[model samples]
Target chain A: MTSGYKDLSITVEFRGGAELLFEKKKNELNLPGDEEWTLRRLLFWIRDNLLKDRPELFLLGDTVRPGILVLVNDEDWELLGQGEYKLKPRDTVLFISTLHGG
Target chain B: MCSVNDAEFETDDELMQPDEVPQTEGAICKKCNENNAEVVLRVKDTYCSTCFLAASTHKFRATIGKSKLVRPTDSILIGHSGKAGSTVLLHLIKAGMSEAVHKRLMYKTTVLYVDDGAVLGQTVDQRKSTISAIREQVHGLGFTGYAVSLNESLHSSEPKIYPLDEEAEDLKGDSDVVDLFNAVSSYTSKEELLHKLRQKLLISVARSLGCCKVFTADGATDLAITILSNIALGRGAQLPLDVGFVDSRELDIKILRPMRDFTRKELIYYLNFHKLETIQTPGLTTKKEPYTSIQKLTEKFVTELNTEFSGTVSAIFRTGEKLSIGNLEASNLIETCALCRAQLDTVFTNTSSLQATEFSKLISAEGPKGNIGKAAFELKKFPCVIDAAENVPLRDSKNCDNCSCSKGKEKFEMSAKNFEKYLCYGCRLIFKDLDKQHSIPDFLQNSVRQRISLDDMREEIADFLL
Candidate 1:
């Protein structure tokens, strides 16, 4: 299989106003499955494919913005090895924004 | 929504991985020995989900219980934003009032939602819809709900109607709302105005509702961000009243923050654990650039520091709590601020201390790149006098009421007579860039008029009083 061929399918959800960046609260994306897909790689994928207007609100430099919280498969991403946790097929990744005004 | 073709952000570092996972294997729940700990909190307490929730609720109750700021007889108005932190607070309060809990807080509760949607230039319909939705949510929680637009403070003298008329362009008048919209000139000033206006509106609403106490929902992380931001904005003098849990700035209507002990992570966990629903409230920068304002920048900074440094927020908050108001000037001065009502500092005092201060200012003016250097040199030629001896004519004195400065041209002599004076130092900073004096809110103008009348009476009866 070619390394660029889409393989891994996952669910992505945004809440707590993080959806303001994604244009929608939830989406299903097919990640390139030819190699190991890390959370860091997924961010690059999301920024390139998913994020819409004002991407700075969602991603600062390489990772999600400071106030945006990332969770993977119902566990705090911090517990699952943050952005390094290798993504598995059908995994659910969530981003919640704490930056929005309360 | 724009297409992905227009993606503006390019990932700068694609090689970065998730941070190295620390050694958390051996840790177990300190509270409940049966379950393994999932979350480690500040003060180094590890807890299971159930234990963590219990501990959080305990802390919330304890914080309020210890501070005798709120009494059973006092009508309490909670300033809720319907977000995660506030959702957790409201849920906890509801649970506390339930018959299942001990020592139920039977005090009458009211939720005041100051719809700041207008700050983002949301249209009248959009803002009204948001307010109505919030009202429904507030009522659903079984609390007395009162809603107001943030722009109402500008025309506080009148009863403001929400969902403003179609012809009513921008808060119904040439109020400071327009100024705030145009005054996006500086991030610091815009944030300052928003905060001050919100506080002013909250206080007014609380008073009108006959509520004795107002509960703000500033969490530990939020307070930490606010502390640093206040310092950066030169509001160090008001730190105690600004960030303290019990802000007794207004003696009659005290503001308290019971959630000051909880962090954002804890609050989010609490909300998720309880399955409580929260409404998304768009803030000033909901659509604008994130780093445009000091408030936004501070939020970004604090959150980033929090990710790498776990206990940084609590440490900052504890330090802020230790700040004392003892060194501050008297809290209850007669000539208080007309805007936010804090005690005004005396600008033109006739004491020896003022003279010593003047001498030091003169020396500082000659220092390299001194802010007052040009002003001092220019005042020498004009009728203006700098460092004049005692008892100069009022017109010749260079004291400007706009600022507490003894250097600027006397504002009364200038054409800027309409600019409000008697504002506290912090409020003056807020008005620094707001040069459109006519747009100054009626709340401030009315207060100024009241103070003027009071001063007139005092001046007329001065000879007989002594």
Candidate 2:
């Protein structure tokens, strides 16, 4: 058997109780870098690698659930082309669930 | 073009595509018409970041200014959660009051953070840290802040100058909090209680701090959800008071929602642009199911619909704005509800309807058992004797305390004797489920007691005049 995949490094952060789905509010993941990572691809990766439980709460239809805002480098994912945006090395992504009440 | 039914089953990718790209790439600002548009808002409005900020600030000022609910000299208490919406509101208020702004506000502003960690089931240490962070945030903004427990509503002191929690003991009431947690009856009641208690605490804090106006940062989307949820909870009559821009239901301290016209998206954008940090405040969802709570379900429904059917939230809010409880005369307005303190509707005072309701309740309670007992069975057998007893008269409108009629055993219990007279229909329904009468909060109980005593005095005076 030959090992072919390398880890892609990126930072993941959660806010507004989204962190409850993960071990901590922030996590650094090393995803397989064999294929280029899009935001959609990264979501699946996070689901497989980091999401602890309640996957439905964090994901819906290969993307973050409705009312959960996704920001890439402090800018809205929608403005930056949403799920199509490519993940780069050392990129910081934040998922904020506005659904949580005060 | 697909029909609405077909569209509901469309793939997420197709749904995400822009339905109508009204603006060309790198469009000019809608307002200034010179700078490159950075954001496209609503259907057509596009603006650069600077223009968007200015437009949002202007809209905020207009929202508050046009309402005429806030006075120039009145002190305002802000119910701040340090979240995106409240942060933007605080920033806008500060900017509007700055020297650079032309129409500078002249009112003093104080921030009040209600620690809801107890409800969220946070540990004491976690709550302490959260409070300190909030205190620092308030201090960093150069404003005085007060931190109080959400449980303060269980037993609040008389409104005083210093509104902060004086005692260091845990704010979570031992039995009350346990009952609230155990009362897992319905998500609506728990949500309703928390909501009513939060409002009570906010109003108390505002009054104590001498703030004439209390401002909450509830945006259009939030208010729309609330309007529907309240309607589902049998509070349609309170639409105006719940969803209106200015709620004067509390006469002395007006509660204002200056951010009513803004959407959550706009507020989040503002927070991001300004590089503002928000604290993550846990809510009932921490330990509760989304579908179980009417509020959570409604919020999810509204927000999800808003994505597929754009402008749904704004449309709902527009409908809510048109609701009014009619022109209440002074005499009518004085008859306030004991719990929510809103003016009573008093439209269902027909004696026939009241008796019908009582009869139905009795039948439902005594259903299955057929426990009419010997006395009720005997009364049923003799209609003439029952009619004669009803006419037996003159002692009072009600039967004697120890009499069988007064203690009908099978009769449904009315909530807290005369207290039911002062409660609105919604509160009365809620109080019916609460098993412990003593668990009623001090504010409501005191008001009820005072009203009963005043009613007693009026009856005595009427007797003397006769």
Off by over 4 Å in 2: A1-8, B1-40, B43-47, B159-184, B327-334, B346-417, B436-438, B463-466
Provide DockQ values for all models, in the order shown: 0.39, 0.42
In angstroms, the error of model 2 at B6 is: 16
Q: How many clashes in each structure? A: 1, 0
lDDT of 1 by residue, B1-466 (tens): 7575534445655433434446554366788788866665552456778898899889999999999767876788888878877778788888889988889888788787777776766777876666666666666666656666677877646435332122223443333575555754675787788888888888878888788898888899889999998887766667888899887778789989999998887887787667666788667666666567777778878888776666678889999999975433543335567676665542444443434544565767668766665655554332223223221343333345433342443232322232334676566667766655335566665565456445545656778975
Best candidate, lDDT-wise? 2
Error of 2 at B18 (Å): 10
Q: Rate the local accuracy (lDDT) of all candidates.
A: 0.70, 0.72
| Predicted model with the maximum DockQ | 2
Cα deviation at B420, candidate 2, in Å, is 2.8
Chain B TM-score, candidate 1?
0.77
Q: After superposition, how far is residue B148 of candidate 2 from its true place, in Å?
A: 1.9
Question: For candidate 2, lDDT tens digit of each residue in B178-233?
Answer: 46545545656767877777788889888877888899999998899999988877
